[model samples]
Target: MIEELAHDPQSGAPLSSVKNYPGPEVGEGLADVQTQAYRTGVRTPEQHPLVEWSGTREGTLTNGELVSAQRGLLGYFRRTHRNVRDDPDPSMDSTAALALKRLKAEAPRALDSFVWYALAERLAAKGYWAAWMLDHVIARCPHPTQRVDGEVVGRCGSRLKFRPGVGKLEGVCAKCPHEHGAVDEALVEYIGDIYRASFDEEMEARLL
Candidate 1:
């Protein structure tokens, strides 16, 4: 999504909409699945740029960091996307065929076709994977975020890409320093609504 202003939830709070320049390096090597097998929680380059930010340094992300971020994003999807366990599609009507196809198209990572099965019946339902669906629909978010340092507080005048539920660990301008950011619920709901329309309109899945 293009960078958009965040809104306040109580008073039209804005969601932070980050649109990072595509990572500077092309990803090489495979996403680290072995590490994901045991590790927990989301890990991303935005959280660990693997650098010392004195607020004066300017350089592109190292290739390793790019891989780390991609792995983390895929990991985030794996952890969150709905599965057959969640649905127990005993009858396997499998509108599954089409949705899985869409997911393969949507996922940034490319792996074996069986890979999506790990997430199970993705796209079967909305909000079941709200964050994943959100990755696509969160355009022009109106959530509110700010920057504060000591007694100095300033309205954030710049935009950074937002990673759904991942906190502003990496995308907030490194120069700004305030916290307490919140996702705009109304905006999240609005995005879900439109996406749901498209999903229902074109997507027809088996009961699986």
Candidate 2:
């Protein structure tokens, strides 16, 4: 799977896609996590590369800050990916297998693996996991239509919905409002924030 994603079709040269380039949202969340770490007396680096990379300055980050961030990121990643427990899709299983294999092959050290997992957390937070799986793991695109609680919905036009009758175990969807479009975007962002923050904590631990 990694080999397939590494090649450029036209040039046939090895290709790489950047992951977890810090952005405004990540910067803000990191700052929050840093603050929490400071309050808890967690040690951090004098200058966190991620903070600098994000172009947000809230003083130097400490190891404590990274630890806090890692906790949050891992929690978020687990929750978002946990949907597979309810959905039980083979595609997700394949994606997980490929991701693990790539992680093991590429990351020689525990710290290196943490970095890769952190990047993956960011990608998943950005709601790009599905597209990534399609590009790297699955050769074909996802079906345009999805079945939610026995109702068929256009993948692009559907909004995940939770109601009384439709058990939480069974995901439900409905036509998205024109104004709302898709609520999952907000959910994804929320989940992403948690994932990124937790990743920092995990990285800090491995560094220690």
Candidate 3:
């Protein structure tokens, strides 16, 4: 996804109006740091000294280049989170893991907002959304586990509920008995709008 966005070649003209979008504001401190990094083509040593550019690059990077870098960082976080979630290994002290831990500790709210933004983008693109079914929920399989080739692999006759958000299954399936039926169309559109506005803000902050 980062690569695709980097090579889009669209000149980013369509995002011009993103300047006017009214929504959540980026943190002043973070915005200042980002702008400085974009202008100088150098991340602060104390803040992000571990960041290493993949290619032979020199001099200050343009706004587009900085945006690409930001996207890359976000993508790295997404992959690291998935890895840590799916396979827990306490001894594995990888750079991604350390960075994730630092982000969680230092900027928990920003991390949460970014996660939501990423989820909204994915759900909107896939034409599906999730909703909370019950105030208190339990994970239950209606049937016993099925063995595949002598290994218990799958479950049969299970009415699996879709889970949204992070950390825990905070929400239930949209197709539950209550008929939540996906997120509202307006909300989904607004999510997209927020994403665009945020991206534009990040990319255009130096100008401001």
Best candidate per lDDT, number? 2
lDDT of 3: 0.32
lDDT, candidate 1, residue 123? Answer: 45
Q: Name the candidate that leads on TM-score.
A: 1
lDDT of 3 by residue, 125-169 (tens): 334321211111222222224566884333221223655545554
Clashes of 2: 21
Cα lDDT over the full model 1: 0.31
CA lDDT of each prediction against the hidden true structure: 0.31, 0.34, 0.32
Looking at model 1, residue 74 earns an lDDT score of 42
Which sequence of candidate numbers ranks them by lDDT, best first?
2, 3, 1
- Model 3 lDDT at residue 164: 58
Candidate 3 TM-score over all chains jointly: 0.21
If candidate 2 were superposed on the true structure by all CA atoms, what would the RMSD be? 19.1
Model 1: residues with Cα > 4 Å off, grouped in runs: 1-87, 90-93, 104-180, 184-208
Cα lDDT of model 1 by residue, 78-155, tens digit: 322333137533233234334434444443332211223322324444324333334322222223343356421223
Error of 3 at 117 (Å): 0.9
